[model samples]
Target: MRILLIEDDDLIVESLTKALTEQHYVVDVATDGETGWELAEAFVYNLILLDVVLPKLDGFSLCQRLRSQGNQTPILLLTAQDTSTSKVTGLDAGADDYLAKPFDMSEWLARMRALLRRGGASLPPLLEWRNLQLDPSTCEVTCNGQPLHLPPKEYELLELLG
Candidate 1:
């Protein structure tokens, strides 16, 4: 799965990027809201991780704009603001989920997985076609219990067909 991470904090970006990569997710990063917006408009990502306080554009405005444009990509807000109002505002702005700063990585991952599953035609984590099975989270494929090595495009095609 591909994810767009919009965050200015280098430390947080580094940590999240490493963790997401380790989980077999392809991550595209933007340091500011404007850059993030441009990237999001140009590419297709399974999910977006946006920070509330951003340079040029705030996460709320960005989310609203994307929704206005009919973008249905799942958005998860990552911010330091933990107040009830902030959560409500984020949700109102079209965020699928919200995670406060200093959050547990496990919780973040779980929320992301749920959003991705819910956002994309309700696709399950595992896809199956006859004897073939695909595990999106692990990027693994097996045919009749035998592992199969496939190129990226082939893998994607199989996923689409499945």
Candidate 2:
């Protein structure tokens, strides 16, 4: 999955970036809301992890502005404020989910997976083109139901072609 992480805390940013990269996700990090917003607007991210408090602009305004611009990318608000009002504000600003700070990595992974699945990330196991069938989940391919056993690059090319 491609994710945009908007955070100001250096430690949190570094840790989350490492974790997500280790899980084979493509991550783009921005330290402030301004840079984050620019990247978010320029790219089609599968998910966005936005911090509530940020330099230049806050997450709520960023989320709202993005929504206003017709960007419907799933946004998960990451905030230290764990209150009813804060959660409601995030939701009202168009966040798909809210995760309080000090959250477990496992929970974040699960939440991201859930959101992606809801967006149809779990499509059919196979994508067929001509005699080629690609299974993205496993990075495997088969031709006419027989395993092709392609190298990673070959499989990726076939997937791109298909």
Candidate 3:
């Protein structure tokens, strides 16, 4: 999964980036909302972890602008505010999910996975081509119920051919 992390706190950014990377996710960090919005517009991401308080532009406005441009990427807002109004505003501004500060990393990861699973955010874990099946997570390939001795590139090529 590819994630765009928009945060001004360096510690939070570093920690989340390292932790998410360890889980096999490609993470890009933007220190401010303007950069975050630009990057989000420029590339396709599996999820956007947006911080409400940011420099130049706020997360809420950025999300709204993104939605206005017809970008359907999932936005997960991370904020210190836990009020109902804040939640409502965030949701209204086009955030798909909201997580308050002092959150558990496990819960964040779980939520991210859930959001990705609910839509066309990331690639499927498995790919089937003709009579062959490839499991990307396990790096295993099978053809016609028989195991195939295939190199990684060769397997990918065959899968692409189909």
Candidate 4:
């Protein structure tokens, strides 16, 4: 699976990248909300891990904007704000799930798995055209039996136009 992590904290980014990659996921990192927005617009991902308080733009605005643009990618808010209001705001802004900071990693993983299962039902299993194949399950594409190491945006565009 491919996930976009939009967090500014170096420590959290490092840890999450390590954990997700260890699980055979492709982890793409964005340090700020604006960059996150750009990446989200450019790439295709199974999920987005968003942080609330961020530079350039806040998570709520970004989430709302993405939803307004009809981006249905699952977003999980991983922020320190654990209050009822914050949780409500996050959910209201279009996040599929919310995880308070200092959370149990196992629980987080479980939530991700649940979200993926729900989303998996909505998307096509795979896409293919001639010698090209796009596998959404693995976030991989191959042409003529050779892996095509295209960037996310290019890969997404190829999937759309193939």
Clashes of each: 0, 0, 0, 0
User: Which one is best on TM-score?
Assistant: 1
Q: What shift in Å separates residue 66 of candidate 3 from its native position after superposition? A: 0.7
Off by over 4 Å in 1: 122-133, 143-162
* CA lDDT of each prediction against the hidden true structure: 0.89, 0.84, 0.83, 0.88
Give lDDT: candidate 1, residue 72: 91
13-87, model 1: which lDDT tens digit per residue? 999998987666779999999999899999988899999999999999999999999989999999999999999
Q: Which residue runs of candidate 3 sit more than 4 Å off their true CA positions? A: 121-162
lDDT by residue (1-162, candidate 3, tens digit) is 578999999999989998876665668899998899889888888789999999999999999999999988888999998999999999999999999998999999888877776665355567786788875433457889788777545755655654
Best by lDDT: 1
Q: lDDT value for candidate 3? A: 0.83
TM-score of each: 0.82, 0.78, 0.78, 0.77
What overall lDDT, based on C-alpha atoms, would model 1 receive against the true structure? 0.89
Q: So what's the TM-score on candidate 4?
A: 0.77
Candidate 4, 52-157: lDDT as tens digits: 9999999999999999999999999999999999999999999999999999999998888788778876555688888989876655789899997876557666
Better of 2 and 4 by lDDT: 4
RMSD of model 2 against the true structure? 4.0
